[model samples]
Target: MNKLLSYISLSAIVLLTAGCSDDEPKSEHKGLTGYVIEANYEKKALLVAESDKTAKVGNYDAEWYSLNDDAILHDSKNNTVLLTDIEVGSEVETWSTSRSFESYPSKTDLSKLVVADDVKHPDSPMLQKKAIQAALSHAKSISDTAAILIVQNVTTSKSEWIIQVFNSYSEKSYEFTVNAVTGEVKQIK
Candidate 1:
């Protein structure tokens, strides 16, 4: 009986191990969009953080990406550009696929970084100061007391504005999508 149990356990382990093999075909890989926190111009690499509320956006979940020397840089309109043109605070959407392993912060091969320009500052404190004002005006339920959180992950590989409004009195939070280029309110939640 002991021998039989050992055999079954071993078989189970083997099957499980085989199931998790990287040899298995994977689905289509996806791109990651986020702002650059640090750019190692010396190493020709970039430390990109995942863009999301759960992600630190600009600060955390930083992954070191090896940029191909031949990699092309693009402008907001997807025009081919130079490497030196890219800036640290700029947002990027990578075309390369992510690695399979469960590495720290995860890593990916960078094909290119998507750089989109923000034309409107209505939601921005410095550029528009009107961003919050626009958000408040757009959101009927959100009052002056509500706090606004801006996240730029409204779409893929592009930097769009997300106006998140939180009201302590009502104990509710609202999210709104604003066009980074147009400064228009796209959606309200």
Candidate 2:
């Protein structure tokens, strides 16, 4: 009877220890810093870019992402912002968990978006798909493994498209900028 009791206790301890394992994956989240290149309150989604000019996360992947209506959005001063308040070119920091980095664009949905009043926004006109079509056409040769790619549009002093590509295996990202009206590929900073 004592041996049986000891065995059961050992089993319980082992199970408890296993449940407390640190090796298990936890919710490791990253904050993505970028600007809101597109905002559609009707759709309750916004495209954010971590790099003002290109997809330059370097060795680290771009952690920035999209924000739906469910996400908590607040201004830099902590004032709450609804989907209708978001504007293009507004500097935004969003929180994201899992992201697909295997393509040129890092596609993700963030939990939160922090917007500041100081972020300048541009009056974006109705989107034209030509630039994105041009970008997607150019990206085919750059990557084939990508399942999701991030796309952002800007219309400030210069109209351009920012395409972010991600590759998880190589940990590589490709970013491109194309003139919106001209559909000409240019060097992205």
Candidate 3:
């Protein structure tokens, strides 16, 4: 009787330990869906706004999310994509760390990013990458040490990119307005 009871207790303990083991598969992490209002390719970060609030209009309340070094990036089809491939105005879902810094635009670390299939402004001729290149090129012509300070899509009746570049040598910032359709860059400031 003692032997049988000891065997039963050992089996129960083993079963309980197995049930609570870390080897169990974890459930998929939940993600937040937002619109990519701004893409800082240089920094590998994005400013995203809640899709429900800023789908078709402004991004006044966007938050900044820096992509982790090991962050998984894929499209809706699950095809792997580079960070530069993500464009502004695209809808994306992100999985991020729990911690975020409190600031004007709260910042967080992103672990995964997926570009949604149903992007609203996919037909735009001038993508954000092209617009940034154009703005940077124009900025370099004026100052060799020019770096992008801000890139914003100012689409109204017509699509436009307002790129702000800072010149370290001159200690001044210049805003360039690039025509999103024609890629014409003009110094607005």
> What's each prediction's TM-score?
0.44, 0.45, 0.46
Off by over 4 Å in 2: 1-28, 40-43, 52-70, 99-101, 118-189
- Put down candidate 3 lDDT per residue, 9-124, tens digits, no spaces: 99999999998998875343534565565689999898765533343333333468888877899999999999988876566788875466777456888888898764222446
Candidate 3 Cα outliers beyond 4 Å, as residue runs: 1-31, 53-61, 118-189
TM-score, candidate 1, is 0.44
Each model's lDDT comes to 0.56, 0.57, 0.66
Task: In model 3, state the lDDT of residue 59.
Answer: 32
Residue 61, candidate 3: how far off, in angstroms? 5.5
How much does candidate 3 score in TM-score? 0.46
Tell me the tens digit of each residue's lDDT in model 1 across 34-131: 65545677777765555454455333344666676556678878798666666554566776544634564456667667776743444343222234
Rank by lDDT (best first): 3, 2, 1
- The C-alpha local distance difference test score for the whole of candidate 3 amounts to 0.66
Predicted candidate 2 versus true structure: per-residue lDDT over 37-96, tens digit per residue: 455666566666554344464432344355643678798888887777766545667776
Residue-level error in angstroms, candidate 2, position 57: 8.3
Model 2 error, position 59 (Å)? 9.6
Which window of ten consecutive residues has the lowest lDDT sum in model 3?
148-157
Error of 2 at 2 (Å): 8.2
